[model samples]
Target: MIEKIEDIKRIELSQFKFPVNVYLIDDLLIDTGFPRTAKKLLSYLKNKKINKIVNTHGHMDHTGGNSLLQGYFRCRIYHYPAKRSYTVVEKLLFGNLKNFTSETPPEKINTDNYSFEILYTPGHSDDHITLFEKKKRYIFSGDLVLHGEAREVSRDVKIYRAIESLKKLRTLRPEKIFPGHGEIFYGYEVLDEKIGYLEDLGERILRLYEGGKSVKEIVKIVFGGERFPYFFIKGYFSCENLVRSYIKDPKSL
Candidate 1:
């Protein structure tokens, strides 16, 4: 079932535990959830008149429902023109390969509604973009700013970019945030928190590197104490990427 939060509605789909938020403005649907959850989403949309569809970004979990939604609504899908190819490859790699297939490049998305501006905040991925809706004072931040425990598991270049992106977002002064993977936050405080976390991690890794620590050693030190083994690999990967980023440019911290 989809829970309505003010003007936005969200549906938690499947056991994948994917949280797909569907923002609505009367007849317009801002985003569609994962493709594997298309049937349920379609059923929910059957009663509404959906004329426009846009994605926050092009990750598989976010764009997975695009093809089926396009077939059902027969409407143009809008996404950042600059990020289309990257989004496509990302979906192909992580989406349910057997069930969801790719589509042609997405057409350019341009709108006159000055209510929101697309901020190119690449960190999580080079194609990442954040939608700042001034009217609502909310930002539809796609994986660039995560709530709860923050993770920095991307290419070193991307991690640096992500930090830069977060800095850019801090300037927006958004009152709230709707992220891709977690609960909505009340204010920009979360952004500051994430930035601090990344900065601190970067500094720690730099210190370890100065002490002749390898990525493997640092990963163990940073995350070996965590109780959940599930996070070991991801934490290690993130540390490795940070280490690489630090090596490339010590000033990134």
Candidate 2:
């Protein structure tokens, strides 16, 4: 349930697909696990002295347990300070997501002894933010930097914005990445790798678009051949959504 990464602790339920990656470093709590793992998360938080809850983004899984945690700890919460809205496709696939809000945090999040800089990194979602610790070169990146290539995170994600966010993160030259889904990355060129992934995907999108392929056709040509969860649907969780995102922000090309 809880694992050690130096002084920070990672709490995950490990029950279903892509569980939330919540981290506790000193007095800061970055992202909360889903509702299914709330009990375990509460157990871990009960013994700790957390003063602030900083959410990397407003995704449901990352913020599901916020009310419960806030009810228990009654600490200040931080996020990208944006209103929430759902796309027609997302509503059809996963209905009724809650809106989350938090005051824009100050430049420096000064805890008892440690501090971090809050960065607004939008792409996967509009309200995404990444926390960077300057002294240690550590970044708490939410879904902004997942393990692999970015695609169809939601129908609303912006491919260009994601690329821009990655570029901004790469500027920080972080030594380690604490992501939202997978294990922690240590001493690796994590940001550059993600940037390269998006660059390559953008190239593929442009090549397909130049060939006069529709978004649906592009999806099929790019990722439709891979079989796993049937991806025939047009709007909901299909590569077509990714194609549309790339089309909107083709500057990445």
Candidate 3:
């Protein structure tokens, strides 16, 4: 059991323990999994009827199955209007580096079966979006919100945007949050946790900056301990970038 939520179907694929949830409702398939898992997904939907496939964002993991799924089902793909250019960049990067090419430019969603209100939450990525169902009070938060461990917003622009988006989401008072990379959260506590984590990190970075510590020095002091993974060195550098960016605009902290 990969922790299935109401009104959503869960499918575990490969080594990724966090299974992808496909929201099935009246012929709509929201957010397909990575390309490597397409075969299993196709098998799952073989006899089932589907109308359209919509993505909460344009991350490769989210839209990697697009081309393959379209080849079989020939269904229309829908996503937020903001992800178009990012989708193109993703296609270009994957196209040049990988043998498989499964990228499809999605269309803007405008339907009646399910009404969606979009929140431009750009922290995990510049083009991130969360979809809210007004009637159900359910949010398909791609990466803006997560259930476990805080996410890094590498860029200052994205961090500011994420804060704005989170503030906007606070108004919704959503009952449940279906995130892209984790288990669904039951209440608004998850939102507060995310905010608190970011705020703490921001404050620490600001204090280190005020103490005249170089980014590398701060990285060693703050996260160079054994608690942090060795592989996260690059991520630490990204966080340094965030720190530098925040230095330029202290309001972000």
Candidate 4:
């Protein structure tokens, strides 16, 4: 379904366990939901003009429909340029990226009414970015801001970097957030909650590490035990990955 917010239109493509959202502003489309849901996305924008595409990140859920949309609209796509390759498991989960090559977007994106500052907010992933319209204080926070606490993270997630990105967003004090997943939320309370949780978690992990507690012991003590879904994801998202993040980048603590 499509919901209008001012001049922007939000297309909610997936409503599963992890919901996916894509936004449209003027001729620009921010983040494609998934390759499987590309048809629905196309249907919503059938009567609209989408000349440009900008992705918040390269994750499958976010960029799955890139190839299809670009081919259909013959539009240019933009993303933060990175030099990393995906793992076999990552490809299996996030889907193939096809031959889509995105140029680097400018510091600001100017549409008919609003001009968005492309903030390089990399926490969820190194190539992650968030679009901000300073005048309206609106943020298109990809995976950087979610509704719930991020207890488990994937292998590529740098918790310290995520914390820093959250802090950066907090400084903006955005009035409303158009997230990559979930609903359009108001205020910075969710950002605060995530920052506080990560900071506290980092401190605790640092303390446990200083006390010679192994990652295994830390995960057990902090999270109690591995819950469902972690085993199924091949340990891609786990408390242990969160614990190791501090070890990898302890200076942040």
Top candidate when judged by TM-score against the true structure: 4
Question: Model 4: how far is 187 from its true place, Å?
Answer: 1.2
**Alpha-carbon deviation at 113 in model 4, angstroms:** 1.5
State the TM-score for model 2. Answer: 0.87
> lDDT: which candidate is best?
4
Q: What would the per-residue lDDT of candidate 4 be over residues 1-253, giving only the tens digit for each residue?
A: 7889887889888724556999999999999987678778887777788888889988878887887888788888998873336667667666666667578989999888888999998878889999999999999999998877666777768888888898999999999999998889899887888888888888988899999999989988988866645454646767788788888854763
Q: Rate the local accuracy (lDDT) of all candidates.
A: 0.65, 0.75, 0.62, 0.83
Can you rank all candidates by lDDT, best first? 4, 2, 1, 3
Q: Using Cα atoms with residue i matched to residue i, what is each candidate's TM-score against the true structure?
A: 0.78, 0.87, 0.76, 0.91
Candidate 2, residue 226: Cα displacement in angstroms equals 7.7
Instruction: List where candidate 2 sits over 4 angstroms from the true fold.
Output: 82-101, 225-236, 249-253
Q: In model 1, which residue pairs have backbone atoms overlapping below 3 Å? A: 35-64, 35-65, 123-162
| Residues 145-211, model 1: lDDT tens digits | 7765543454424666778899998888889887776667888988889889888877887898889
lDDT of 3 at 186: 80
lDDT of 1: 0.65
Candidate 3 CA-lDDT value: 0.62
List residue ranges in candidate 3 displaced over 4 A.
1-4, 14-21, 82-113, 151-157, 225-253
Q: What lDDT score is found at residue 7 in candidate 2?
A: 80
Worst 10 residues of 1 by lDDT: 97-106
Candidate 3 structure quality by residue, lDDT tens digits, 1-253: 2445554655544424435555555576667776666667788778877767777776666766667777777777766553343333344433311222223333234344666666667756665667788887877787677655443333424565566677677789888887776567787777877777777877887798899998767766765632334444334324455555545674644
